[model samples]
Target: MPKISPKLAICIVYVAAMMMDGLDATIVGPALLAIGGALGVSPAATNMVEVSFLVSFALVIPAAGWLADRFGTRRVFLGALAVFTLASGLCGAATTAGGLVAARVLQGLAGGMLAPVGMAMLFRSFPPEERLGVSRFLMLPTTLAPALGPILGGFLTDHLSWRWVFWINLPLGLATVLFGLLALPEHVEEDAGRFDLRGFALATPGLGLLMFALGEGAARGWGDPLVLGAGLLGACLLALLIPAELRSPAPMLDLRLLADAPFRSAALVAVLASGGLLGMLYVFPLMYQDALGATALDAGLTVFPESLGLMLATAAIGWSFPRLGARRVMALGLLGAAAAFVLMSRVAPGTSPWAVRALLLAVGFFLGHAVLAVQTVVFDTIADEAMGRASSLLSVLRQIGGAAGVAASAAVLAASGGAGLGAYQAALLASVAFLGGALLFALQIRPAPAPQLRAEAEPSV
Candidate 1:
């Protein structure tokens, strides 16, 4: 009989954890309306309950390094899964929007550790030739979650109750934790050096101020004084955080690593390119429901194929990356996505939903590398000691990019007088343009020579 490898076992835990991560992000979207009705709150209140999770997830990412260093990746991840499971179940019990929002915050805190830590482990342990295999395998759960979340969450919300959305996490989390206990390997980590209290203070308010501004702008209008003040404060905080990291004894993000051109370029490109990808997602469902007059089930059904396309793309690229070279592979993906967005821009009243689904499927197919290759480049440049910090920075950047993308696109469309299908069409066109630019930038990343690829990339975390 053949023996199961340790890497394979770890991959199992990775898949379970990532599937839940994507599931958590999308599960709320389908249930948000049901939750509003159940709690007798306005749609906006219920939406905040969802935003509360994103905020917590973004805010905690920078600190994941500190926590992981003090506790070790394996221990922190298991603890996080337990916390997420317990909190999700409690969310199922809540009768009020506030209660659900509070519970989601707990889940977010727990979840913040899982993705970055897992990425660190894979980066540290896998041989370079094996990364695409690991990335492809891990990508499956993420791909399935969104496509599944709406279908499943929508079904449960419609047939069961919205609370079941939270209830669903309990069994999944428990199984992952239990299975991981026996399968996930342990890596010993050193004691924390000096704590970067200043760095934490900087990043916390830096990201928090920006997110608060964007979220408030979403509901209250960007012209409001509060939003303007918050934006100003956020920009200043970030300006301070960059210099502070350069000077700190224990910088949270390790700005020095920016010396590596490939890693630095990839990170910046991610910040730029990811905007339209997530923004369109934020825009599309609203377009369907508010303007196009589609039912919840119809909207989800139309979108599921897109998620499937993305999952399939991730798997294909992971299998092909070693042979194609990361630069050529990623550029082709972005270029394909750019074409998809251009197709979406042509939508008008009575435009075929079949065509729309085809466009979305194409978009998802190429977006697999936003995380997959970005992290691969980052891990290639940094050493083991910096793995935790590097992963945290990458995760935080991705969140910021998504939020910024959605808000910026919406702002443009709104300012253009909300002019029927023209506005929607224009916004989609802009998104395509953005992705095309990302493709240009992606072509610049240099893959590691086969001889230079690390045997154990990000081992200790």
Candidate 2:
């Protein structure tokens, strides 16, 4: 057998970590009903399983960069894997809804660190100019994991136990640890500074509160005091976190990165893309089930073609990015995504399911192109030293964007007071508006000039 390149191995590790995050996020959706039934909880109360995970995940993300810097990427990654694996086991064994929610919170805390830490490792392993190769690894998890999550969840729930979903993570997590121990390189910062306690105090709870408010806003009323107060308090804390970090000698998040033109534009693209994609993820299941009256399994299968479209576009981007320039390709992707949303917005109650599926498939293709293009180009502007914090910031923004998308889309649905199809359409139109704004940001993403590579430490596996 041919030897695997060290860089390739690292990229594979990163993709695997991302896949875990994606799979967990999507897989639980299908199992919610089963879990509620098994636990003898009301559907409203059971939704807290997902909510707990999201809140805990958001709380830990800002700390990921700091931990990776304080320790080493390898150590942090391994630790995260351990936490996630053990928590998955606990989640599978839970007997009560509260117990399950607690286990999931632990799982989310661990999962929170995986993606950003893995990203810091990958970006540091590859030079900026050469980072386009990272896309080959990223595309699969980004495109397929969520798309496959519901299908796999449905299959497991129907054929086996819902507990199998959590059980499934065990072997994968163990293998990841073994491979990582052998192959993943340790990257430590030169001046590993003190823990930013004040910054952490502000940012952590701030983001957590904000995510909770946004996440729960639609489910509960936005006007609810919990939602209103948390939103206000979180916003204030986050606003204060900015100057606190900028003034601190060693910042956790490095908010200064946003000052860079390329990074800022790319960050905007990340936020917008996440918002739109997550919004669709929220809406499509409703469209299939509530609007069209399909079964859970059928709804999941209907969305499966989207993965095919994403894979096709991602494969094509590897060829097209270098030839056509990232900017043009990304612009085209934004427009394509906007078009897909436009089509989806016009979908009537009686519209053929196949027609709706085709539009979703198209959204996957176009959005895939947009996601790959921006992720590839963004790293070209980041230096090795700052990659950790930048990766964490991007991850945080993506999560926030997703949470906001779910909230905003849900609000729109609630406002329509549902004659079924009309609510979904209005929600989709809101997504289209988000895409249009994202396109404007895409237009501003100028091509980053190739970076000047320097000789330093190179990894040998």
TM-scores, all models, native as reference: 0.77, 0.79
lDDT of 2 by residue, 1-461 (tens): 35677787787777777777778888776665568678976333344566567667766887887789889999999889889989999999999986997899899899998877887787788898777656554665654676688888767876898898898888988888888888777888987668778888998778777866765565576899999999899999999999998998877778899999888887788788877776776676666666666656666676676766776775677666666676777788888988888787777667887887788788778888787777776666889998867877777776667666666676677667633777878887877777777788888877644422222211000
Worst 10 residues of 1 by lDDT: 452-461
Query: Candidate 1: which pairs clash?
Result: 123-458, 124-457, 124-458, 124-459, 310-364
Q: What lDDT would each prediction earn against the true structure?
A: 0.69, 0.75
How much does each candidate deviate from the true structure in C-alpha RMSD? 5.4, 5.6
Q: Per-residue error at 254 for model 1, in Å?
A: 1.5
TM-score of 2: 0.79
Q: Runs in model 2 with CA error above 4 Å?
A: 1-19, 31-55, 65-75, 89-102, 116-147, 161-163, 174-191, 318-324, 346-351, 379-385, 446-461
Tens-digit lDDT track of model 1 for 1-461? 24556687677777888788778777666566567667875333343565557667776777665576687777877888889889999899998766886798788878877877777677767998888777756654666676687667767776788788789888888998988777777774686566778887887777767766765564567899998999899989999989899988777777877777777778766766667676666556545644576655666666677677755765565565666666766687777777777777666669888988887787777766444555456566678888667666766676666656666656555655443566656656656766766776777887554322222222110
- Sequence-dependent TM-score of model 1: 0.77
Which residue pairs overlap in candidate 2's backbone? none
Which candidate achieves the best lDDT against the true structure? 2
